[model samples]
Target: MTVATFDTAVIGGGLVGCWTALFLARRGARVAILEKGSVGAQSSGTNFGNLRLQGRFPGQYPLSLRSQAIWEQLQDFVGSACEYERTGHLYCAFDEGEAEKLEGYAKVSESYGLSIERLGREDLKHRYPWLADKVTAATFSARDATANPRLVTPAVARAARDAGASVFENIRVSEVRKSGSGFELRADPDLRIHCANVVNAAGAWAVEIAEQFGETAPLFAAGPPQFVTEPFPYFMSPSVQTIDGSVIVRQTRRGNLILAGYPRTAADPASQRVPVPPQKTLAAMKRLAELAPVLRSCSVIRVWSGTEGYLPDMVPVIGASETTPGLWHAFGFCGHGFQIGPGVGLCLSEMILDGGTETPLEPFGIGRFRSGVAVSEKFRREFDERKTA
Candidate 1:
């Protein structure tokens, strides 16, 4: 087959990849996307749709806020329904340490001009009767939102295609190498992609593929095996589980409750692994009951799981690689990529096209780590010190 070329080749067609492609294409840059499966068929579509801006590390706080702005007006540009909803998020504090952390975050978030209201348990109970007593404190981010990922991402790809960007679905990249003044991508089952820059937004598989180009930055899987429940009324609230928690039960605009959460079991190493069993379901159900007592009546009609990568510092690496000069990273979201994907994708595209991002993408660079190794020890030590305070 003839080698397909573009000014830029985006390696993954998930939301991040599609957003990156469309954003760049809109700027008149030729863009192409290669997907290992149908567009937005993997983690981008599988996970819960939380356009949240709560409880994120202060460093990522600003990026998420910017993404929320894009999500607010995305449908206007897409010319179709993306199903953005004002399903406010209530980030709770189950312990004093958590409360302190929440308090600290709330103070700084205001400086970003985000309207996050902190509430005591009593105040929470008065406003919403759904919460359990286990919640000691909570912060409400009214700016937060949720969207049907199933709709938003595909629309992005469609828009990109409409704007002259080409997308290849189910064409897996087998190998990558620097070629001429650009790069060459070998796709399995057939096809080769040669372009000036290659983007790795392969969702769960990003780390594995990035390493083939010599990026060994210790990005491991994070998020639990998740599943969704049948449709229900507007309840459950668009909330998140913290203190390393999961069980992201949110009511869809279609009235179905999306049941999903993190589990302790790890996925197998061979491929994008996710195993769901009876025991796992039962344990998650129990946790769900504590968070929302009404969930006792809601039976778990289905279950699913997906793998997501985690950098040791709990941040993503974006921009030109130290070893692979033309390569740029857009992975390791630590399960929170969906909310900030638009901002990230836009920043990456800018970095590729303009040589540097106007937005603050420095905290997320690979250089933050110690020569390709993670700063997990520093992250843990700081986390512990915060707990004692």
Candidate 2:
């Protein structure tokens, strides 16, 4: 077997792993990315592409804002726009209870120095005349944006390769064990990878790797159902969603409205299959129409979903391993990994190279799961009780 050496080995080629490799390679590290399949072909590529900042977990504001900064400069960093746009994000409220939730979310965002605009029913009608009368209140954040999920990971991987990082696709890592002061990764087709540090950003399949080091998390596989309508007139700009976690929709410049909703469907990582239930499609369609009456007639041209790791607490596991040195984990992001992917990568690179990052990652530490995990309300509301894996 041929053995390749690197300063850091990133296991997974999704946005988080690819961006980690890119930043590490840029810092003059010998980096290699081992992916089971093509980069971004899974969850990273199939996401709804909402780079939202509003309504994030309070502890995640710093990281989310940092990630948005990178998204704003993606073209210069990765040499592609990836269809990124700061078209803003509008979170609507259907009832007074939902409106209060929006207000609390806006306050949380404001504390992080993010500008949030609260809009009443008349304000929503004036700005988004297409919205239905039931949308009683809303909040808008210009900082929230969108991008092409399908294009980002590949572009970042190319940049990583350009910066002297080796990217090995279609390579499934079968075993990873600590070797002396470094680690050794054994993969299919008879290849060995040795590295001083290892980052397991393996998305849905990351828990298996973490368990190898005596670390465990209540990670499950699930994905939001996504649908896209046939091209129509381009009018809707901002990404819009309901505060009650019903549906989210955004229109492409090409006039197709992309829609996604909660009560995410369960996924199977072993089979590499993520099936979007027919009932979810119908329910999301109804919610979208209720949110915006004008889009009721829009025909859905396609529907899809992908496997994503979700923790019971609805938080991602990041930072160094609790039991193993030089090993880091960044996975189980639920379905919100796309927007914060870049920032997480950058932070990982800093931790690997510069010793630590300024970002507050203590909340996402793997040690939190040591004493059993608590299920979050958001998790309960966003996912079906039976569908979770």
Candidate 3:
């Protein structure tokens, strides 16, 4: 066979990789995507589809904002239906302390241009009569919404293909090495792909790809358990979250109630399979019952799990590699990449094509992990200080 050379090679065909390839190909660069499976077959298609802005880490606020804006105009770019729904989002609190924290967060969020409204106990009960009586307060971000996870990545891949990008499905990259002028990717059997630059958006298997270039990050597999109930009356509209990060509940357009909030199971990134624990499902169902008593009559019809990468700092690693030139990394999204997938792609495309991005990529560099201070330790210390504050 002949050599396949491209200006850029993307190592994943998920939503992020597809968007990155779309932007690069649109910019007149030769781009090809290598996917171990069909596009959005794994985490991208299996997530709860929350395009939320509330309760996110402060560092992710800007990216979430940008991604939300892109999501609002998704069809304009992808030229396909993503099943996007602007159902708003609500974070409920069960106690006064939790409510106070939410009130404080709402105030802080306003400075960032996020108009989150805090509802007191009476106000929340009056607006959402279905909520559990234990709910003391809630905060609502009207711009937050949900979409069809199953449709997003495929739509993006189709858009990228229309923009002159090639997507190779079920072709796994066994190994990658720096060649004389670029990188050579060794694939199944006799396939070899040469590219000037590679973007490691390999989803759950991102760490392995980054390691080939001498870049190391602390990423672990976290599989959030999810289940869907039989179609019922569409009572709930907005996606709902708890202030303590326990249970997330949402009702789809088809009236199927989808939820996730239990102990995560170990995930195998290589296989991209995560089995939901039976006990965890029961526990999550119990919690859901407490949050919304009306769910007691709803029977869960199906349960599933998706493999997601979780970094120690709970942040993503984006931008150029520190050790290897002509290499870039954009992975380790820590279970929240779904909301910011498009923004990450746009920023990375800008960095690769324009030498810099409007979005700040310094905070997500791999150098942060190289520092003597471990992210887990820093996070623990910060949490302790916050408790005192």
Candidate 4:
């Protein structure tokens, strides 16, 4: 059968994949996205929609800054309502030790040009009295924001399609191998595609595609439990987090409180499915009540979970393939890729079409795990065991 060809074929139609295709097509490169399921039906759609710049790893701060700027201008290009809001992020510390840590992080983050304002108890009470009295110290970053997670990826996919990228949904790639100076992909019985370059943006399943190309890392599926409360009078302003890393709390414009915490559920690798255990939600609610007494009276309306790729160090693989030429990877953002999704796609597009990116991608290289040629079995086994357990 004659194979349809393009300049690039992006596997996995998550936010990264769709944005990559959109940027590539805008640059006049023929691009196609092959998705196994519906666009944004997985992690990207289910995340808490936090566009935060606070509490980011040092290496990720630069990329997140660029992403935040893009998110502000993104609606003009995507042509859809993202429900974007610059709600800011307030991280509260319940005690002296947590306050010290928050202060340290603020000092370091400020070195990177991030504006972090440390707030003492009196400052917090004066600015945000809605918070519980236990919050003795806090840090605020006003530029951090939120958006509608359900609307982002699909809007990007539609914009990519409108920009001349072929998007084939529900086409699971059965096999992918190097072809003559390019790569070939077989989706099913009769569908085949050949492209000069391939991108593995398959979210949690990216490990399998990376393995097929002789590259691997300690990536495992991790699920974060999320819940929303019934709509009430919106009292909370800025999105809140604990310096102790206990929980994240935010209130939507319509007055629903959203929460996520450390109580994790397992995600199945084979099916890429994460089950939301009711017990974890209960535990999260209990912790929330402890943090903010007002939440004790709130009624939960829904609970859910999203499967994200978690590397051992919690960073993602976001560079060219170490083994295969013309192949690239842009997955494994841990559970936080939603915020930097657009910036990552632009970086990958620049790397592919322009030979390099202005954004420093050195820290995200696949070779960090080992040599630039193959997977390290030792790292793989450790992460696999931890994931399964």
Clashing residue pairs in candidate 4 (N, C-alpha, C atoms within 3 angstroms): none
Candidate 3 TM-score to native: 0.94
Which stretches of candidate 4 lie above 4 Å from their native place? 371-389
Best by lDDT: 2
- Model 1: how far residue 190 lies from native, Å: 3.5
Q: lDDT score, residue 365, model 4?
A: 90
Model-by-model lDDT, in order?
Answer: 0.75, 0.92, 0.84, 0.85
* Cα TM-score of candidate 4: 0.94
Candidate 3: lDDT of 249?
Answer: 87
Between the candidate structures 1 and 2, which one is better when assessed by lDDT? 2
Off by over 4 Å in 2: 382-384, 387-389
Each model's number of backbone clashes?
A: 9, 0, 0, 0
1-389 per-residue lDDT for model 1 (tens digits): 75788888888888888988988998998889998878987667766777877667778877887778888888765667678888787777788998998888788878788888888989978886887788888888887888887888899899999888998998888888899988988887768878888888876577777678666567665345566676667755565554445456677766667766554345444566566767878877888788878777777777765556666676776667777767887887766788888888888888887888767876877666655544554345433233211
**CA lDDT, candidate 1, residue 250:** 71
Q: How well does candidate 3 score on lDDT at residue 230?
A: 94
Say which prediction, candidate 2 or candidate 3, comes out ahead on lDDT: 2
- In model 1, pairs of residues that clash are 226-304, 227-259, 227-304, 228-259, 229-259, 231-256, 232-255, 232-256, 247-261
lDDT for each residue of candidate 2 in 1-389, tens digit (9 for 90 to 100): 88999999999999999999999999899999999999998899999999999999999999999999999999999999999999999999989999999999999999999999999988888899999999999999998899999999999999999999999999999899999999999998899999999999999999889999999888888888899999989999899989867798999999999999888888888998888878888888999989988878888889998889998889899899989989999999988899999999999999999889999998999899878677898787655467433
Give stretches of model 3 more than 4 Å off: 372-389
Query: Mind giving the per-residue lDDT tens digits that candidate 4 earns over 3-39?
Result: 7999999999999999999999999999999998899
- The model with the greater lDDT, 3 or 4, is 4
